[model samples]
Every structure is written in C-alpha cells, then in structure tokens.
Target: MTTTFYEEIGGSDTIRTIVDRFYEGVATDELLRPRDPEEDLGPAADRFALFLIQYWGGPTTYSDNRGHPRLRMRHAPFAVTPAAKERWLVHFRAGLDAADLTPEQDAQFWDYVTHAAQFMVNSLE
Candidate 1:
C-alpha cells in the first residue's frame, strides 16, 4: 500500500486543525511557556503551525521563512526537566488524540512526539 502524505493521516485541513489545537494547549501550558513575557502566544502558534505543516508534508512555509529548524539549539536556554516533559506530553497527547487520527497514524505520530520530547530533555538538575 502506498501512502500519499495527505491520505496517510488526513490532509492539509487535518494538519491545520491539529496544529491549531496543539498550539492552544501550548498557550496555556506552564512547561511550554511563552518565551516573551511581553507577548502572548500568537506568534509562537504561527511559527509552530508552519513548522508542523512542513514537517507533515504540507508546505515549506516554515523553512522558507525561518530557514532550518534548529529545534534543540533554539530550546537550549529553557530548562526541560522531567516535570516539564511530562506536562508537555500531556498537552500534546491531548491535542493529538482530539484530532481523531487513525490508530496506526496515532501510534506513529505519538512515537515521534515521545522521541522528540525525549530528545528535548536537556537537564535533570
């Protein structure tokens, strides 16, 4: 069976929908706090949305605008303890589950998230 990127999970709209929901959680998540106190999460949401689109075979907007995704480097300043990782996974899993992804797709997607979250772990103390 061939996997058309769109059909593999859903399509552009599904990506957009999931991203929007994920960012909504991030907006309120203490673990994934906004980098700027003076600004709300609107900008972060936009960036994350673009990145997800491109990552999930939708568009190249994120790379076009921001170049390569230096994810770990960008997050280096923040402290990603076990508690923060747990909190982040909670919100992320919630958003992903709410998207109604197929069981296989959900497992694949979650595996990526779990690994990514593990990779983002930069500190234990």
Candidate 2:
C-alpha cells in the first residue's frame, strides 16, 4: 500500500493549487486578461487539474469527463499572440514555483506547458 509519485505530490490537491495560481495570473495579465477577464475558468481549471493528475499516473478523471484534451480546438477562439504566449508561460512558471515540486517534476510540468502554449499560438499577426 504505497502512494505513487503522483499521490506523493498530493494528487488533485496539488493540481488544484497549480491551476488556481496559473488562472489568477491569467485573470490579471495584460496580454492574456482581455479575452477571459471575467469568464468562468472554474471548468477549465478542473479539466487541467484532472488531466495533469492522470498524466502523472493518477486517476483518469480527465478522460472520464472530457475524452481527449484537443487543446488547440479548445483555444481556437482566442488570439494567442506572442505576448499572450509569454503571459501564459509566466503564470505557469509561477505556478511551478508555488507548487515547489521537485526539480524533475518542475521540468516535466514546464515542458508540457511550454509546448501547450506554443501550440495554442494560432496567429503571427
């Protein structure tokens, strides 16, 4: 009866903390704040938390609820310019700091965020 690294890091609790912190920045960031300033990020937050936990080898809550992430289609409405990309990364990096996860975990987490943000960039204008 031992917890995996996913559970060792506190599973959903840790994921919630990370998502909340990231969204807090997104809510106020100059580059990313305009589109969804007051939008309900609650659902989005839950989705991300579950997805991360599952990806880390925890439960499959994300897939249970949302099939596949299909992140690009989800973010297609927004104009993810370079500034917005930077802002998203800034908030995500801050969340990693707040989580205070191990260096390995931090690097892995940031890798996903970095690639995800890059993929979300739909325009060069």
Candidate 3:
C-alpha cells in the first residue's frame, strides 16, 4: 500500500511542528497578526495542526472536533488581500522549510499551500 503524505511526513508531530513554526511567524507579522484577535496563538495553532493532519490523510480529529472546515467562510471575515496572501505564504514557506521534506514531498505540499492561499483571497487589495 502506498503511504499517505501524513504518514510519510511523520504524522501529528511533524504537523504540530509546522503549525507551531508557522504561527511563530504569524505572531510577529504585522499584517497577519491583526487578523487573529486572540492574544495567544495556541488555539489557532492547534486548530491548524489538526486541520493539516486531517487534510494530509492522517486522523479525522479536526473534522471530528470542528465539524466542517468551511475554510473560505471562516476566512471571509478577514481581508485576505494579495499582500496578506504573500505574507501568509512567506511564513508557511518557513514552516515548510523547517519540515525538511524530500523534493517530491516539498513540491506537493507547496503546491497545495500556494493554491489554498490564492483561494483564500477575499479582497482585491
């Protein structure tokens, strides 16, 4: 049987690391920081880690806990302009780098993130 990306990438621990690193970037970013009203990014990090795990074919914990992802709807309240998307990608790229994935895995993961970032753009600015 072929291994899923989640399995190949070392499961929840790796996912947690990626999310944690991504949020560390977010925490310091002026553009990305204001979107999240919470002072602590812990909750956001957990939710993202779970979501990524589920999306990558790991456990279903994210949906089990949060129902549907409804990503666009959830992000609709935010002003996801081109600049915001770029900033988000910059941080996410850092997380991806920290993962130290193989070339194929890196390409696959980067493709999805870039697409998702584009999809989440809700404003023209």
Candidate 4:
C-alpha cells in the first residue's frame, strides 16, 4: 500500500504540534494577533490543526466539522496583504522547523504553505 504524505510526516499529533507552535507565534505577533479576536487561541488552533491534518491526507475531520475548506472566502474579511503573507509564512516556517521531518518533507510542506499563503493574499496593501 502506498503511504500518504501525512503518514510520512507522522500524522495528527505532529500536525497539532506544528499548529500549536504556529499559534504560539501568532499569539505574540502584533501583525497577526489582532487578526484573531478571540482571547483564547485554543479554538483557532484546533481549527487550523484539523485543516492541516486533512490537507496533508490524514483525515477528513476538518471538513466533517467545518464543511468545505473555503479558505479564500473565509479569509475574505481580512485584508491579507503581502506583508501579512510574509508574517504568516515566518510563523509557519517556525512551526515547520519544530517538526521532526526529513529535509524533503520540510521542503514539501514549506512549498505548500508558500503557495497557500500567496493564494490567500487578497490585497496589495
């Protein structure tokens, strides 16, 4: 049987850890902090972790709980400028760095996030 990229990277727990780390950065980042209005980051973290888990081929819990991942539409409320994308990538890069993955896996994950980040950009400002 062919293993998935999720399997290659260690599945749900790993994804959650990376997301937790990502949120840790987000919690402190001035640019990103105001984006999440919630005082507690747990809910946001859970949503993001589930999204990554499903996206990486682990499970469909995200869609099951939240319906389709209309990423752009969901983010439409936000400005999502170039600077925001860069800040987002920086935190995401930290998350990926904390994961126990091989170089290839890291690069693959990075590539996906970079593309996804660019796609999320809805404004030049």
TM-scores of the models, in the order given: 0.84, 0.83, 0.97, 0.98
Q: Write the per-residue lDDT of candidate 1 for residues 41-104, one digit (tens) a residue.
A: 6677678768877787777889999999999998898888777788788877877877868888
| 31-86: candidate 4 lDDT, tens digit per residue | 98999889999999999998999998988999999999999999999999999999
lDDT of 3: 0.93
RMSD (Å) per prediction: 2.3, 2.3, 0.8, 0.7
For model 2, how big is the CA root-mean-square deviation?
2.3
lDDT of each: 0.76, 0.81, 0.93, 0.94
- Cα lDDT, model 3, residue 119: 97
> Which regions of candidate 4 fall more than 4 Å away from where they truly are?
none
- Among all windows of 10 consecutive residues in model 2, the one with the lowest summed lDDT is 29-38
lDDT of 2 by residue, 1-125 (tens): 97776787778778888889998887777777777744787876777788888887799888888898787887888888887898889998888888958888788778878998888998886
The residue-level lDDT of candidate 4 at 66 comes to 92
Question: Highest TM-score, which number?
Answer: 4
Candidate 2 regions exceeding 4 Å error are 1-5
Over 4 Å off in model 3, which ranges?
none
Pitting candidate 1 against candidate 3, the one with the higher lDDT is 3
State the lDDT at 33 in candidate 2: 71
Better of 2 and 3 by TM-score: 3
Candidate no. 2 TM-score: 0.83
